[model samples]
Target: MSSAQQEEEVLGKAYDGRLMGRLLAYVRPYRWQVVVATLAAGLHSVTQVVGPYLNKVIIDRYLFPTHAPGSHSLIGNYLPADPWRGIASVALLYITMLVIGFALDFLQTWSMQWVGQHSMYDLRRDLFHHLQRLQISFFDRNPVGRMVTRVTNDVEMINDMISSALVAFFDDSFVLLLIIVVMFRFNWKLSLITLAVLPFMILATRAFRRAVRDSYRRIRVAVARINVFLQEHVTGMSVVQAFNREQRAYDEFDQINRVHLRAWTDAVFAYALYYPAIEFLSTLAIALILWFGGLRVLNHT
Candidate 1:
């Protein structure tokens, strides 16, 4: 590995609030887009909660009419006596919510993409400008490939985090919270039972993330090594041919290629393990919901 690659092997903290705050500095100029994205996400979250609720209402009020319009009925006085009318009304609202949610989600996605592209453009321009001002010694110490990767790969990763991961994280959190709230509001006991697997799922997800991260880190190192090898070899191809060292160069390249392949294999293994684990956990959760929530349905609880 190059000295630059070795230096990058030092794994730092995954999150740094101050670093994130600094990143937001770039978005400050495009606050309007952020605001619109936030609004769209917020609207989307509300629809996520409300849409499911409409289905629940359909099941409880229209399909079964558990408690027919009577003195004890909660909405008997306000809603139409005909259950079909009530179902149609709620279904209309559900469709409306779905349409709005789709539009808002699309808007948020497009807006974030725009923000990411623009922000990265500025960031890369500034990065190149700063690199131009750096001392010659710094360039001498770092491989040209590593420097180029900083401008392209590393910056692109950061842009993805900012535009996609960060925003989605917040929106998903809100949607999850809303789901939990709605679930408990509908049936506290059933919600509690369904949520029992959450801790185990969380643990499994954390383990998966750690494993994949380590594997991908190895892959990055391997890829960087490959990049450095290619850059140096291509740049010095004449020197090797002059010395009649083609066989030696080929052997070295073969060795480096194998290392890169092994790293990629490890990453693929991690990915293969993670996704099935997630699918299994998801199926397990569904099974649990059916087993327990089915009991609630039978008992009319």
Candidate 2:
């Protein structure tokens, strides 16, 4: 199987519905916090949208309509019929948005953390519980490192991916979808232009992901080899000195360090190109929006 396919299979085995369902069963008592947190996320997104709309209105109705850039107005049309009243209204609205956004952000951070750490607590408990149930023969055959790897590093990676990447994916995708819908509503032609380079962006993303994965894998291998070399030489230092094998050990260490350097360089090069390409595409979208939106606004059609 392809590495991508293998990775997916591993993730699937790690997070089967039966497994997660059983895990979430422990969170039944905290369901209220989960529900409230989800609602807060929605409100956060809503307020984010509201802030920008308010800015656009202020620009169009007050700034753009009257004072040119760098010119100070005499506090005329920009002021409402009641200046303090209008100022107070804007301030209150902005404060409300800030308060809501902060509250939601805090709730999200807390909820995701509570859910993640709590789930891990239950999972580790179960894994240890299951490990104890295994026969003594299994333990005799498998090295302690193997078992430690499963319970420690593997579990940590899985938890990090689910809590950080999974949550981020959901939040980012929902926000992106909502933004795209709004953009389409504003101007379908511009939206199409904005999305025209999506395939390229996706391809770039996949390439970067592969590059980083390979770099980290190589780094891990190199580190392991170095560790083994160090352990052998340190343990057998007396024999090595008697045989005068210091030069040989130095050469081996140099080779391992070179491998690590090469892997890191490749990773850096991949991201160096990947990020600029993505940024260029994003800039192109802005240019397209301006060129197209300007035409529509000019024709008033």
> Highest TM-score, which number?
1
For model 1 the local lDDT of residue 219 reads: 64
Model 2, poorest ten-residue lDDT window?
5-14
TM-score of 2: 0.70
Clashing pairs in 2: none
Tell me the tens digit of each residue's lDDT in model 1 across 1-301. Answer: 5567767776657678998898787878888998898888888899888876666666766676666332133343565657878877877877999999999999888888788888898889999999999999998898887777778877888899778986798689879888888677656777777777778778877887787677667666666667777888899999989999999989988987887788678778877877887788778877888988788669965
Q: Score candidate 2 by lDDT.
A: 0.69
What's the residue-level lDDT of 125 in candidate 2?
A: 84
> Model 2: per-residue lDDT, tens digit, 146-238?
455456665666567645664566556656777887777665777898898889899999888877877766655555455656766887899
List clashing residue pairs in candidate 1: none
TM-score (C-alpha, index-matched) for candidate 1? 0.87
Query: Where in model 2 is the C-alpha error above 4 Å?
Result: 1-34, 65-88, 135-141, 215-269, 297-301
Query: What is each predicted model's overall lDDT from 0 to 1?
Result: 0.79, 0.69
